[model samples]
Structures are given as structure tokens and as C-alpha cells.
Target: MSLLLEREDATLEIVDDSVLTICGEADFDSAGPLAQAGRHWLAEQPAQTEVSFDLTGVQIASSAVLSVLLVWVRSVQRHSLRLNRVSLSPALQRLMDITELAPLLPAVETTCAEPARDRR
Candidate 1:
């Protein structure tokens, strides 16, 4: 895997030409740059490349993280790339479930070690 962008609390890396892995806290402060970099990277990939977003390393899965994910999703669509699956953290899965935005993403895989807790 090759490192693409690295901030203090977040890192975006290309697992291969086909998979992008985002690790750490993708907070509101990092959202804009993360989205822009992710979009640019997606735009550069060949259309035949199937894409996956690996967010299992993210802890918060805040709205900012979702925003970044959405931007990357749109970028993939615009580039005519196929989205395979989004590997998610437990927190991210919970956030998506709460927001009802799961359908906006492709197939999801909960990859984090900890399971999402029941808040209710």
C-alpha cells in the first residue's frame, strides 16, 4: 500500500490501484481536504478499476466523515468506476443506520473489531 495524504489525525492510502483506505479521525477540520484529495485520486483511476473505501480504522464516523464518503462516492460515479463495497467501522455503521443514508452507499462490511453497541 502506498500512502497518499497524511494529516496529524488522519491518513489516506491506496491499498492498491483499486482500494482506498482511510484511517483515523476524519473530523470536520479534515473533511474538506480529505474529500478533495479522495476525489482527485478517484478521478485518476481507470474506469475498469473497482473501488472500495476502507473506513474500518475510523473511530468517530462523524457527519464530516460521512460527507467525505459521499464526495468520494460521487467522484467514483463521475469517473465511471464501479464501487465494490465500503468497509466500515462499528461507529460508522451506527451513524449510517441512524441517518438512513446507508442506501446512498454500496454494499457495506463492518470490519472493526468492536461491534456497534445498542443505544436503545
Candidate 2:
């Protein structure tokens, strides 16, 4: 399913290997789009497979970005998906660290060009 958020500078798209590339600003304004698109992706996972979010493209954001990722992590766990290590931006890592959600999302620092790996 294509759950891309349509905006002037932001987007949420299925790039490859079930990785959703969330680009641009993810502030309170974009939070709903992120959450809605994310839940759609999570619910559609047919098997226990990794789901990655390439957040390297995020230029600006707020805690809503973390909220979106946290919700996705919870949905994956609740659905018994084989998900882990959501590729995140360094900024996002720092935010998660601040919020104490870094452990739950199992975030990794990597670009979207790199293979989205499900490192245990």
C-alpha cells in the first residue's frame, strides 16, 4: 500500500524492503499524516517481517515524530512483527535519548541508500 503523505516539503513513502521514507518536517502539523500512514503500513504486514523507517530525510521535526515512531514500534510488537532497529536520523536518536524511548525503537544511524537491516 502506498501511504505517502502529500505535502510541499514532506513525504512518507515505501521506498523498498518495507522501509517507509519519511522526509521533510514532522512537526505537530504532520503528526496525523505520519500516524495514519504508519498504522496503515503496520496493519498490512502479512508476516513477521522487519519494518524500517528511513528518517534520515527529516530536516525539521518535533516530539510528534517520536510519538509516531513509538506508536509504530508498539503496533509492530502488538502484531507480532519481526521488526527492530528503525533506521533513524541522528537528530531523532538524540530526541529519543531525551525522551527515554531510544531503547524501545532500537534505532540505528544509517542513510536510506543502505540496506534496511533487521539487526537483532
Specify the highest-lDDT model's number: 1
lDDT of 1 by residue, 44-103 (tens): 988857888888778677999999999998998889888887888888888889999888
Against the true structure, candidate 1 has what lDDT? 0.81
Best by TM-score: 1
On residues 9-28, what C-alpha lDDT tens digit does candidate 2 reach at each position? 57787866578778778788
Q: Estimate each model's TM-score.
A: 0.87, 0.79
Over 4 Å off, model 1: 108-120
Give the Å shift of residue 53 in candidate 1.
0.5
Candidate 2's C-alpha runs over 4 A off are: 1-3, 106-120
Error of 2 at 17 (Å): 3.6
